[model samples]
Target: MTLLTVTGLTKSYAGADGELPVLAGIDLDIHEGEIVALLGKSGSGKSTLLRCLAGLIPPSSGTITYRGRPFKGANPGTTMVFQTFALLPWLTVQQNVEVGLETRGLPAAARREAALTAIDLIGLDGFESAYPKELSGGMRQRVGFARALVVEPDILLMDEPFSALDVLTAENLRGELLELWDSGTFPTKAIVVVTHNIEEAVLMADRVIVLGGRPYGSIRAAYDIPLTRPRDRDVPEFSKLIDTIYRTMTGRADTPHPPHGLRQPAKRTPANTPLPAASVDGLSGLAEILQRHDGHLDFAELTDELSLEVDDLLPLTDALELLGFAAVKGSQITLTDQGLAYSAADVQTSKQIFATAAIEVPLVHFITTSLRNSVDGSLRAGFFRDVLAHHYTSEQVTQQLDAATGWGRYAELYTYDTRHEEYHLDTVPS
Candidate 1:
């Protein structure tokens, strides 16, 4: 049965100057008896869409319907589990689970039974009275699950819930949830989970939807996970799916930044673009790893070895390419002479060589030139902000500036004073 339907969904935020569209022309549907995983990088609209589905926020344009009725507020019989445990510290596990019941004016006796049942279902029966602070991270999350399940929600929305847990714990929790879900012990009709982990998405969901790049994104692709429950991650098909997503998300290594997905603006990350957060050290580390395999490591091999998602891997590679250290083509990474050299260089030599390449970036050059020409060799960082605002969204501009700042700071091309938001020439020689 169709549980929820979204049509022509568009959402925007009012920026200082105008409406900044986060999601546009998005249409989606959720059905009964399926777990849907929303996957994307940091800026993608997965969370925003989740919020919209939960009715926590209204879409700027579009309609979301629940059971064929227009959804105006929080969807009935729905609850959310957050990435953070979000358990009230003062409330014991049972009390925490009972809070929702209390809000519904359920009698004390009924609330206790419902909360206890949920607690036992979530394996927290023994910890019924344990405070959140006294519990391990995993147990605290179990309390979060118990609290949500106590309401017997029709649809459960999970926002990176397992991201905060340790690897083993998360795996264990996943196993437990699947076991209960498959055995008819858990009763939720449907679920939506937001995650960055590719393996996790493929392992748990009936469908995996890519939210794509932002400040513009929505339902770029939906992949069906046809594998059976308790899918083997080491199986060829599973491993192939992981690599396919990596390539799809990151694009051909030879392709420039923002290589694939929703947007197709430019071949390279233009000077005005906000580079995703990455570092010279990270670039070197990837380069070193690639070099160890003779600079011909395929995308799948590299990601498996490093355990990096497309979002985590692509930006770092973009930074390296932007700085002339590497070249990416298809699924392979080839180190430039500079990349190999940087990998082998002593600390000082690496930074010095990097300084020369870093200055070649247009934004970095602009900062250095502007600071060099200033009366006191300084310029307000806001001045750079003005330049970026014209080219990108306000939030993206901030990210761009951060990337620019990190590059400048490392190269000693300029110094940034966070307290004053000023970019001044570094007095220390490079």
Candidate 2:
């Protein structure tokens, strides 16, 4: 039943000071005909673990066995789908799907048929000839998926394949994928997904694997996603599961305030305390930590507070530095006043954390900033789609926003407004 088993897997990279370990003493077992979801913060080694499982990178120490044999490297039947669509620009959809089949060396006619079947299976019946540029974000991702499917891999590896997609498109694709899996088509015997979305994991995966910080991608916890097939997010059980997972990841207490069952007011800290000029700009780890806690937070007390081991905290802390919330002054972490304000601001107590308008601040700020500074008016449409689709990297998002807002480069991209369900532009910079 164990299709893939990894034991004591360790990986490291050379750093300025020493060998920086990225993954350490990791252990995992994936069964046949199951989907395993890997959850973590952005740089929590989810991608590295996925690469290791796919044999894209060899671990420094450990044994990986697939179906009881050593997993030395990528096999003919193992396929991966990356967050970026990674399609050939010049190739049509059909051609891109067929590209994987080149190694099979089947006759042209046979290959064409196989490619067509894959395209259809992924719901791209009429899009076979469209180029990557012409296809929408969702459609292009499907083409990447079709490419993976054509190879008939035993295990499919997905590194946030839907993360770049807009919510509606991503939801639609998730539904279609589940239907395909249910129907026993598409060729993958098992699947493993690396994702930051807990709801997606709960809905799609049979098992959820939580990866904790860097120096080693260690398992913080593994929970069986007990919801039945065709789960509905509107249901109470579904909401409960999401809430639990969120609490587990961020070391937050279950139900910060008593009995807010489904809906609760957003928590905003009183503007007291001297607000320090941010050591750096942008959302910090404090934001992530506070979001995990549903906005009721304690600084200094919560750092290194995760259930995951000490080795798993470094990269997370390092990333916090980029967000301007985490600073190391001689082995001590000091949270800037901005970090505290952002973390303690109007966050709703709803079970659906992501569904709240407060959740839209960062995203809206990101989008608005881009639109304000764009040189070409036409690029706005594509750029908007990219944000909705979730295709671009954080760097890409910031770059576009910076480019769009050429006037005031230091505009505060987000703010809390109770009347608006999402962050509204405080004032369009004149």
Candidate 3:
């Protein structure tokens, strides 16, 4: 009972100077009543595949068949919910939901009935007449869902629809969607959700598809979600699964940045001048400085205090600085107050991003947030290491976290005493 089948799908677009392929030789089958998770990085053609399957974009050379027939462009049997809620502001909730039915040119009474049913199904029973402006982020997203469902599509295509909602609201909607899907009362024979969240994929998808490779996205791996429905996150198996998906998605078995005891050379700045504030350009020199110093060193000792080379820092320093989490001045390159704030925010933001990816289990994002908020010292390091340990060594976590926080001061305080092979967090004496 295959609801949709896409074969020989390929897509390419002209770039600034030449044609670039986004998807190549992708073949996928979505079965009846099954949820399929499509996982990939930002530009990895996950969305392109979804758009092609939904007929939003025509493939360069491919055929998309819906229920054993060639899918005509934007047919009623298929509906899509975009990451951005596509509700018409001028329209009331009821009107927005009804738009799906209007395309069918159904009679007025039939359209109204279908719209009301969708509204109820999505838990908007009392607010049928409210406008998009009158709803919360979650409710607005529900309107998008209701609209998609009203058409009674055989297959539903969702492109990270919950990515925008708050966590509580997203979780609620997820529950609702699952309830409806489990009840088997709606016409939805299958669903295809595209996400960057590995946990989201594992939780909802019966089968998880990882789009890997370069030039054109290829299937890196396809895993079956064997966990029982409504799985617990605290379980060991769950954590293991999360770790596995994360490694696959990032295209590495272990963590990308490992901590070496080597400290970067310090970036020199004025003794009293507050660092000009950290930017992505200076993060690498700052990192190398910290490594050279073996952790914490005063700004005056840095070799390149006045002028620092910036090109050597790629992805690492760039990501840290561009995100506004570190800074440098004449004698001292230190973490700006904002940098500290970002470290805290990054923990939660990363969690949210990971949660949206649709993986059943949560790993990196989960551990980062977990350690940031915990009160116990060893628990902080232990739990932190527990999650990060699989992909990175304790030293690596310490180094990356150190660079990220511009907490070279903290890094020096805590170093692994290999004699005991235990991490010791040193509290600086005021």
Candidate 4:
């Protein structure tokens, strides 16, 4: 049975120039007896979709139905577990767990009983009387779980619930949750989790839905997990699935099963090819690592060796790709000749190489050309920000400018005066 159905969902927020779309034409269904993981990088609208399902935010357009009924406000059949734990600092664990019940008008005694039961089930029975400050990160998250579960809604929504915890703690919590789920004592009929961690999604979800970032947030692909519970990460099938997901997320066009959504434009622009939030040092460090590995490295092995999540590493790789320094095919990242030279060159030579390569990046090119054309070899930052405002939200404009500023400064293409908010052409020779 389908617990939730979303059709042609579109969500947008007010931006400087106009409405900025966050999610577009999202079509999804949350069925009973399945854990669906919404996986995507930052800005993919995973959390936005989850909030839409929870009815915390209204969609700009489209329909959401719960058990065949139109969803109007707070979803009666859903409760959310947040990444931040969101517990009242002054409240005891039991009181925090009972919050939803209190709002639902359950009698005090009954709420207490239910909260205790949930606390016990989530391995926090002894912590019920303790304040949130008295608990560790894992235990606080357990309280968050208990609080959400105490409501016993038909659908449970989690927004990066494990992201705030340490690796061992998160692993342990995931195991405990799965054990409870397998024991058939878990209250919810369905679970929807938002995450950027690909492995976490593969490990915990019965179905994984990948969301794309470019153009807007929309489902790129959905895969059903056939592996049984307690999946082995070391197995070949697991590794293969992870690799496939990596390829999909990285937008490998030749990937066997192409995702169903907007393809990145053949012509790159500042709007479409926004600079990845990576620094010069970060991308250069990765290139040096690739140089050490003979100009190529399997994506998975590099991620493991660096002990970084896919989200953490992707920005660096994206930056390298944007700068024409690297290429990613399937699960392999190969450093290009430009990348090799940049990695091997001395400081001054490397900056020159980077400047030449960075100019190919649309935003960087735009900034450099605009500065060069200026009568005084300078322009106010507001001029560029206003030009970009048409294509991005205010926050996005800031990020774009910041990225461009960093690259321009490092390449000596331009120098930004923090106080004056201006960009000046670098007169010094490389």
Go through the candidates in order and give each one's C-alpha lDDT.
0.79, 0.64, 0.61, 0.87
Worst 10 residues of 4 by lDDT: 255-264
Worst 10 residues of 1 by lDDT: 253-262
Off by over 4 Å in 3: 252-430
Q: How well does model 1 score by local distance difference test?
A: 0.79
Per-candidate TM equals 0.78, 0.64, 0.61, 0.79
Deviation in Å, model 3, residue 296 alpha carbon: 18
**Model 3 reaches what TM-score against the true structure?**
0.61
Candidate 2 structure lDDT: 0.64
Local accuracy of candidate 1 as per-residue lDDT tens digits, 313-365: 87787777777888877677788898888877888898898899988787788
User: Candidate 2 on 81-149: residue-level lDDT in tens?
Assistant: 989999999999998998878877888898899999898889899998889999899999999999998
- Candidate 4 lDDT for residue 385: 92
Model 1 ranges with Cα > 4 A deviation? 16-18, 252-277, 288-296, 304-312, 321-329, 334-408, 413-425, 428-430
lDDT (10s digit) by residue, model 3, range 287-345? 54554444333333443453521212223332333334344332233444444433344
Per-residue lDDT for 65-142 in model 4, tens only? 999899689999999999989899989999999999998899999998999999999999677789999999999999
RMSD of each: 5.3, 13.7, 18.7, 4.9
Error of 2 at 277 (Å): 19
